[model samples]
Target: MKLKTALLASVLTSAAFAAQAQEVNVMSWGGSYAKSQVEAYHKPFTAEFGIKVNSIDADNPATPIKAQVEAGNVSVDVADVEFSDAVRLCDEGLLEPIDQSMLPAAPDGTPAADDFIEGALQDCAVANIVWSTVVSYNSKNVSGTPTTIADFFDTAKFPGKRGLRKSAKATLEMALMGDGVPAGEVYDMLDTDEGVDRAFAVLDRIKGDIVWWEAGAQPPQLLADGEVVMSTAYNGRIFNAAVAENQPLVVMWDGQILDFDLFVIPKGAPNLENAKKFIAFSTGTKPLADQASWISYGPARKSSGALVGLYSDGKTQMAPHMPTAAANLENALVNNFEFWVDKDAELNERFNAWLAN
Candidate 1:
């Protein structure tokens, strides 16, 4: 019942249950869902080690982490950062390199190092969570469930209340796809103003019907309340609602954004050694697979990618929450972390202005 500080070193100390009690600090996103999933990652981890887990969380974790590293008093040994935020911090030299040798072997003994999906893992950060914004439609109310982004925004066909995520990048990418852009061309098209405007123009046409959900889980909530017959929602939450509640909600993986969040070691973290141990352990098969069951977020570990205990049926797994559906995985537009990392302020400002207007 007592909430002990869950910090970075929590993973290694949690493992082995050895006599040496070391304290490590971890920084991560917090909410009941996020907190519970993160804490679950620590459970099997702590069982093997003798260290104590101290987890520190925040609403928006980037700026505080930057300050901590800049001040040269890095108490955060391991940090769970958003995909975009990780890129920004890495550019500022606040993140440390991940040493692959420390990681445990992949199940079945295939090497995990560099075996991850192409471009999914990076130098300073490794994939921790794989998520997607998917098309979800109420099966009970709507005659035919929508399966594509274009179908989600199609008013005449699937007419009802609709919702779209409020974020700039994911929305832009989805809009482009809705406008008929191919998955491969999404990044190239987004590199130009015309392409960007074209995507927004599609949204402008449906802005009135859209609920504009800012939080990831909002789509699923809206669907349940009947506020939206259909909307773009997080894959996990949508899948959970659909399978657990057997709601008529369904998803189309035709065009989705499979965004991955990562764990980065702050440059001056209080305990770099323990942090690495935690990361390696977290990305290991067991914890990664465990979080998948509790939360819909897919594990980053390539070895763990083969559909764990989340759900068995293909129909259920393809809901807006699960990223493992072959069709959806192929259609996903991975976020361009390099571009956004350097252009965060300018792009985000422009994005806000665009949204306001």
Candidate 2:
């Protein structure tokens, strides 16, 4: 009787341990961005909760979320996606609506909704970082420094192959800015047919000199290989290239398109409860601020800003490198999520037709 009782107790303890060892699969853009999350979120979350997190990479995490939800075979538990994708996916009923109340308040007790930046928290998502797509050039390859957006289109002046993301979103906005449209009016201008033509007209000047890139990692590599002298890249990637790799790359912040990357859970996530816990914990003040140490992207919470200091190198100051930094914001365009949510498909179709032409 004593032996049987001991055996039963051991089996129950084993079952409880197995149950407590839940894991979440998180998908994000690979490279420095992924590394930042691993240090700031994944490792800490596991340490705190004993929940294992599986890190996965995709060129764009949003693409797979839609497929997984629609097919009813969701594998991803939590995903890092862009503002527009998060909004669109939520609208299409593909994502689980996040309860903002579950998010931890600021250290001083400010509510999560009040602590996060305006537009950072959405119905189905919570933002993590404010990143920008900006132009970067190899200082060693360029003849003169580029101080403005127009310089990106000036092949005759700068004279080298240019690298651009093969997407219409940032490409159109950057073109308009290069054509001298004010950052505030970029989306307003693109809303008109003539304005779009003007953007394409700007693109026409450098069409022959453009080398297109599709992945986040490609732009930095393109600059390093001298495949293109100037490229529009995620600010963090260029920072890593210059600060981490000791490359001659210089980021031109004049025409940057700033946007947010948010955390969201899919509607049919296998581990919904754990997924929510991960989002709430990872997006808390300290973790969000901790992420800044690994990448140049700005944290979404205003409170996190004060905590941001040096880069992982411990010497490179993160402030000047952030897209939200005062000096850098002078000419930066905030990505119009509503405009993109409505027009992304239409613009991309037109963009693809133009690309093939």
Candidate 2, which segments miss by more than 4 Å at Cα?
Answer: 1-21
Instruction: Give the candidate number with the greatest TM-score.
Output: 2
- Per-residue C-alpha lDDT of model 2 across residues 196-219, encoded as one tens digit per residue: 889888988888899999889999
* TM-scores of the candidates in the order shown: 0.80, 0.95
> Per-residue alpha-carbon lDDT of model 1 for 287-306, expressed as tens digits?
77667766677777777766
**Each prediction's Cα lDDT score?**
0.73, 0.94
